[model samples]
Target: MVPQLILVTAFTLYPIVMTHVYSLFEWPGFGPLDRFVGLRNYTRILADELFWNAFQKSFIFMAGTVALQLPLALLIAILLNSERLYGRNVYRTLFFIPVVTTSAVIGIVMRSIFASHDGLVNNGLQLLGLIDRPIRWLAQGDTAMIALILVASWKWLGIKMIMWLAGLQSLPVELYDAAKVDGASFWQTFRHITVPLLVPVGVVVLLFSMVDALTAFDLIFTMTEGGPGFATEFMELYIYRYAFTSFAGGLPQLGYASAAGVFFGVTVFLISLVLSLLARRASQVRR
Candidate 1:
C-alpha cells in the first residue's frame, strides 16, 4: 500500500498539481517561468475557435464510438456467453486480439487499408460496383472523421465485449434456470432478467468507453495526425499540439496547453461525476 501510494503521488497527483501551477504562467517548455498571466490562458482557450472545434470533434468521436461500439460488443458478448455456442473460447480470443494489439500498429495498418489508391476498402468497394473510382477516405474532413470513428470503435470493441462477458457470467444461474423452467422466451428473459442484472456493469463499461473515446490520442495521431485540415483532431491531440509542437513557427506554449489540459480534464471529470450520479440512482432504483 505504501509503495502504491508513493507511485500514485509521484506519477499522477504530482503531474496534476504541476499542470495547474504551470497554467498560470506563459512559459515555454524550458527557460524561465517569469511571465505570470493568471487566468489569461484559460480566457484565451475559451476564445480560441480552433480549441472549440477540437472540443466539438472530441465529443463527436466520443458519441460515435459509444453509439457504435457498445451495442455491438454487448451482442457479441451475449453470443459468446452462451453455453450452446461452439468454440466459444476461440471466438472470445479472436475478438479480444485487437484489444491487445498496439494502437500505433493498428493506426498505421488502418491508414494503409483506407488509403485512396488501390487500398483494400476502395478496391473492395469498386469490385462490388459500389463506386467506379477510389474515394479519398482520409483526405476529406467528414470522411476522415467517419474513418477515425469506425477504426476506433473496431479497436476498442473487444475490451467492452469482455467487460460485458464478465457481467453476464456473474449473473445468477438459478434465475436463468427458473426463467427456462417458466418457459420464458430468449427476448423476454434478456429484457426482464439479463438487462436489469447488468445495470451496474453497464454503468462501468459506459464510463470506460466514454473516457477512452475522449482521451483517444495515439491511434488518431499515428493515423491522421489531425490532418485533412484538423478534421479528426480530438481534445487530447489539441493539448499535445500546443504543449509539445511549435505552432506558427513559435515555441511550444506549455502554459497555455496546461490550461487547456486542465479545462479538458475538468470537463471529463464533470461528465464522469454525472455518470456516477446516474449510476447511483440506477442502483437505488434497482434495489
Candidate 2:
C-alpha cells in the first residue's frame, strides 16, 4: 500500500510541484535559471491581451462542448438502448471510431474539410447555393472556434454516449416493469425511474466532461493551432507561443509559459471542485 502511494505521489505530485516552481522563474528550459521573476510572470499573463482572449475563448469552448455534446450523447444512447432498435452494435462501433483514433489524424482530416477554398464543406454549400463564396472556416474567428467545438464534440460524444448506454443497460429491469405496471407513461417512467438511477453515471460523466473541456488542448492545437492571428488562441497555444516562439530575435520566455500553464491548471481545479460538489448534490437529490 505504501509503495503504491509513493508511486501515485511521484507521478502526480512531482509534476505539479515542478509546474508551480517553474512558474516563478523565466527559465528557458535550459542551462540555468536566468532570473527569479517572482510574480512578474503572473502579472505578464494578466496584462497579455492574447491571454485574455484565449481565456474568454476557453469558456466559449466549454459551453459549446457541454451544450452540444452531452445532450446529443444522451439522446443517442437512449435511442440505442431502445429494445426495438436494430443494428445497435454497428452504430456504436461507427460512433466510437473517432474517439479511438489519434487527435492528430482527426485534425488532419478536419483541416482538409474546413479549408477555405474548394473544400468538401464549402464546395457542397456552394453547389447547394448556400453561399456564393467559400467561407474560410479555419481562418475566420468565430468559424474557427465553431469548427473546433463541432469536431471536439463529435469525437467525445461517443464516449459519453457509451457510458450512458452502459448505465441504462445495467438498470434494474424490475423497477421499469413496476413503473409499467403502475400505468406510468413512457416519459413519467423515464423521469422517475431512469433519471434517478442514472444520476451516478451522469455525475461521473459531468466530472469528466468538465475536466476534458477545461484541459482541451490537443484538438484545438491540431485543428486551428490557435491561428488566423490569435483569433482562436487557446491557453495551451498561448503558452506554447510564449515558451517556444523565439521573440525579439532569439530569447524565449519559457517562464511566462509556465505561468500560463499554472493559470490553466488552477482554472481546471476550480471547475472540477465545483462540479464535484454539484454532482454530490444531484446524486443526493435523486436518492
Candidate 3:
C-alpha cells in the first residue's frame, strides 16, 4: 500500500502540482521560471478568442460523441446479450477490434478513406450516383468536424458497448424470468425492468464517455491537425498548439499552455463531480 501510494504521488500528484505551479509563470518550455506573472496567464486565456473557440469545439465533440455513441452502443449490447443470437462473440470481437487498434493508425487510415479524390468513400458515392463531383471531406470546416465526431464515435463505440454488456449481464435472471411469466413484451421488459435497473451502470458509462470525449487528442491530431481554420481544434489540440508548436511565428508558451491545461483539468473535474453526485442520487433513489 505504501509503495502504491508513493508511486501515485511521484507520477500523478507530482505532475498535476507542477502544472498548476507552472501556470503562474511566463516561462517557455526550457528556461528557468523567472517571470512571475501570477494569474495573468489565466486572464489572457479567458480573454483569448481562440481559447473560447477551442472550448466550444471541445464541448460540441463531447456532446456529439456521447449522444451518438451511448444509445447505439446500448442497442448493440442488448442484441449481443440475447442467448439466441448466433456468433455474438465473434461480432463482439469484431466491434472491439477498433477499440484495441492504435488511434493514430486509425486516424491515418480513415483520412485516406475519406480523401477528396479517388478515396473509398468518394468512389463509393460516385459508383452509387450520389454525387457527380468528389467532396473534400476534411478540407471544409463543417464536414471536417462531422467527420471527426463520427470517426471518434466509431473508435470508442465498442468499449461503451462492452460496458453496457457488463451491466446487462449483471442483471438478475429472476427479474427477466418474472417479466416473461407476466407476459411482458420485449419492449416493455426493456423499458420497465432493464432500463431502470441499469441506471447506475449507465451513469458510470456516461461519465467515462464524457471524460474520454473531452480528452480525445491522438485521433483528431493525426487526422485533421486542427486544420481548415481551426474547425476541429478542441481543448487538447489548443493546449498542444501553444505548448509545442510555434504560434504566430513566436516561441512556444509553456506557461500559457499549462494554464489552459489547469483550467481544462478543473472543468473536467467539475463535470466528473457532478456526474458522480448524480450517480449517488440515482443509486439512492433505486434503493
- Point to the candidate with the largest TM-score: 3
Better candidate by lDDT, 1 or 2: 1
Q: Alpha carbon lDDT of residue 172, candidate 3?
A: 93
Candidate 1 lDDT for residue 45: 97
Model 1, C-alpha of 130: deviation from truth (Å):
2.8
Residue-by-residue lDDT tens digits, candidate 2, 142-232: 8998888889999888899998898899889999888889999989988888887888788888789868876777777888888777777
Ranking, lDDT, top scorer first: 3, 1, 2
TM, every model: 0.95, 0.90, 0.96
* Candidate 2 residue-wise lDDT at 186: 89
lDDT of 1 by residue, 181-205 (tens): 9999999999999999999889988
Worst 10 residues of 1 by lDDT: 278-287
lDDT of candidate 3 over 1-287, digit per residue (tens): 99999999999999999999999999778868889999999999999999999999999989999999999999999999998999999999998998999999999999999999898989999999999999999999988888888999899999999999999999999999999999999999999999999999899999999999999999999999987889989999999999998984589999999999999999999999999999999989988
lDDT of each: 0.93, 0.85, 0.94
Worst 10 residues of 3 by lDDT: 245-254
How many Å off is the CA of 139 in candidate 2? 1.7
